[model samples]
Target: MTDHRYVCSSCGKTHEGLPTDWGFKLPDEVFDLSYLDKYRRTRSNTDLCSLDESRFFIRGLLSIPFTHREGEFAWGVWAEVSKATHDFYLENYSNEMAQGTKASGVLANTIPGFPEITGQALDIAFQNSKSRPFFSFPRSAEHELAADQRDGIGHNRHHQFLELCGHFDESEA
Candidate 1:
């Protein structure tokens, strides 16, 4: 796909390419805490996060295909995992054997324009040492996000997401 150019609504600057990936800097639960509480109860880096010394989370990519395009859009989102799964991930960090490892978790972000999906069941699969794990819904999941993932989304719907996230070409709008 060609690069998408858009004038950012938030910054009021002309951004050259449309971003295919969007992410949250922190999990919603931690993000909602007060400044002091967040720092006192959380320890996080780019890929892993721990809250209250008990809750564990890992960053992952959730990709949805474009119905009429050659590529997919991705969300760099976080997942809440069991302590055992989180420990296993840390133990296998940067190890090739970690590839294909699967774990059950819950989506940790409320994606824009979608109903509250923060606690939705999610399945994660590790790609390799170099890439973040990929997130998916269980086969039995019944939600709009799951349907979009399974059936693909139209270009217009994708554009709506871009706009919702403050990335939109005014000319097209």
Candidate 2:
């Protein structure tokens, strides 16, 4: 049995007991195999025997600043398309792309549902990004994914991507 000791932060009471006696839960850490357990369960049995062995990495990306502990919860909504979700969705991405006609000065006529999905993913990333430890973080950084925590997914590139997209002269190409 593992020895355990803990102190009550509010009551100033000191307690000592077995690790299991208190029944307190602990946060997960990086490099922990169990970190991705939640995502693993959602996968089909035919996919793979294990996550570490899988080509795609499992990430627990979160929108930062989820501090409204008493009010709204991030889980109340969704995280960006999980890396797995994004991978599983690869096939659908192209189909969502429109076949462009140069005559119209556009590549694809309409990306259709792609934009909506894209927006939702972006929103989730931004939410997690805002969940930072410091409030001084630049506003531009708000539209990003959380750090690549052991269990957290990192949505780092989205902002740079959005910036690039904003200035890209598709017509010149």
Q: Highest lDDT, which number? A: 1
Q: Write the per-residue lDDT of candidate 2 for residues 33-127, one digit (tens) a residue.
A: 35466365333221111233332221222223322122211111122223454354333324423222111000111112223222222221211
What TM-score does candidate 1 reach?
0.86
Evaluate candidate 2 by giving its C-alpha RMSD to the native, one decimal. 21.2
| lDDT values for all models | 0.85, 0.25
Instruction: Kindly report which residue stretches of model 1 are placed more than 4 angstroms away from their true locations once superposed.
Output: 1-17, 169-173
lDDT, candidate 1, 1-173, per-residue tens? 76777654446786775656678888899889999998899999888999999999999999989887788888889999999999888889889988999999999888888747779999999878889999999879888879888888888778778777666444566
TM-score per model over all chains: 0.86, 0.16
lDDT of 1 at 108: 89
Task: Please report the candidate that would top TM-score against the real structure.
Answer: 1
